[model samples]
Target: MSIARNVPFETTLQVRDTCLCLHTQRAARALARRFDEALRPVGLTSGQFSLLNALNRPEPPSIGAVAQLLAMDRTTLTAALKPLEREGLVAVAADPGDRRSRLLRLTGRGQEVLASAVPIWRDLHAAIEAGLPASGPDNLRGALAALSQPALR
Candidate 1:
């Protein structure tokens, strides 16, 4: 008998058996979609927002370092940056310390766009926090940190 023929509809659709890495992934995805929609006015995908935010921290970070911080491969990260570069939100420049290295920097326009998106981000964050409690966002952040500590080592 075909497995599909015998299984109940609910059984067929259940994600519970797949060993989901993060139960919050669904929530995260939903949150990202909402953020993406809200950020549409600023012309940023959630992924781009994350990249911009990371690049905001320091200057002259090599492409490899940026990739490492984002937990992505150099090629994929480079691919993602293409649109950002094309839009003039970010720039890649030669690293003075290493001729072969390239540094990723956020542009002034990127900061402006990021600033515009901050209130929307804050709204989304507050919505998430409202669902929890006094310590919601902090506790969730802590949990993510604990979960990520091993991979970071």
Candidate 2:
């Protein structure tokens, strides 16, 4: 197969508009894909990693709180948590203050799993950072923040 070089990225159909946004999304997709492949041995997708990290925070954060933190809808977050719960990696408890809500927390085994995944995560994060230097993350966050403002409004 012949390989073409200098191909422009596009997020939408129109060449001009898509060019502005497509590159970042393409980057995210590619990065996530690479992380997923690397994380396969640890049995954690990037989503699962975020979920476990959220749960591993202070015990018994409300489901709503976790969803908000992840910026995921409650239903989506609830559905995702099911697998972790079934796998004995997470435990959802009834909120003591509010019966209508549930609280999510990681189990001991979950902690162990997260600990196991850390090295792999560190390696991936390091590799990415190394490409853009130490401030790479800060720059990314800034760009994302700037991009999100209009959407939020």
Candidate 3:
């Protein structure tokens, strides 16, 4: 039952205005919504599109490798794969080298769906780029990549 200190509104305002995490999270949410709407016709959310795209590789990638690439934990990646697997869009196979490890590959239907989504993605991406100022997209990408570096964590 000690004293309760009240935080000044100025501090809250400062954080809202200056926090990089807050800004990035807000931007991500907005971008996700935009992509979701744009991709609705293709029957995919932005996350699904990304996950499927990640599986599109010549050689199947291991679960751990994909998790690292997507910046998601193995558990989250596994959970995310379930729907795609159920839809027969992706297949998970036990790695020959390591039975304990699983590799992810896009099924034939997955390739077809991803191919369909590509033009939609390209159009939206170009629109986004056009809306940005000169070099804005590149600068933003560089900044995001820098922020995502493991060292920052």
Candidate 4:
């Protein structure tokens, strides 16, 4: 009665072996785990670190801008900011230029946390690159960047 019963085992194996999305997702999850572990002492997850890092700009970015930079939807970005805001690590205020839009900035506490995170990130990043294949990290980064472009999708 299961729909999976209709599909051949070979098809499943093929997808497992050849699917770029599946491989990328697995790799992304593994990388996130590593970064999460590394950042635990600083009390940030990989996603939170990224969100906080994005907000560490001279000019507070609009919610729309930050969402685009983070490859997230406005709603998801807003949701993610809640905990950081409550912790006094981030501030969200209505944009003066546009009443409906919100601007995001890293608070002084957020800067301190981010400063603590940078060296950890750099060390881990260097270690990861050093362990990568001879094709090297640059090639891997280039490929990921190309894949990130919406037009390619």
Best by TM-score: 3
lDDT computed for candidate 1 = 0.82
Give model 3's TM-score versus the native structure.
0.96
Residue-wise C-alpha lDDT for candidate 2, range 1-153, written one tens digit per residue: 988876555523465555647777787789889888878897898889888988777567998888888878899999999899998999988888888889888899899989888899999988888888677789888987787553653
Model-by-model lDDT, in order? Answer: 0.82, 0.84, 0.93, 0.93
Give candidate 3 misplaced runs (Cα > 4 Å). Answer: 1-3
TM-score of each: 0.80, 0.81, 0.96, 0.94
Worst 10 residues of 3 by lDDT: 144-153
Candidate 1, run of 10 with poorest lDDT:
15-24
Better of 1 and 4 by lDDT: 4
Q: Which stretches of candidate 1 lie over 4 Å from their true place?
A: 1-22
Residue-level lDDT tens digits of model 3 in 1-153: 989999999999999999999999999999999999988997888999999999888899999989998899999999999999999899999999999999999999999988999899999999998999998999999999998879843
lDDT measured at residue 104 in model 2 versus the true structure, 0 to 100:
88
**Higher-ranked by lDDT: 1 or 2:** 2
Please tell me which model should have the higher lDDT, number 2 or number 3: 3
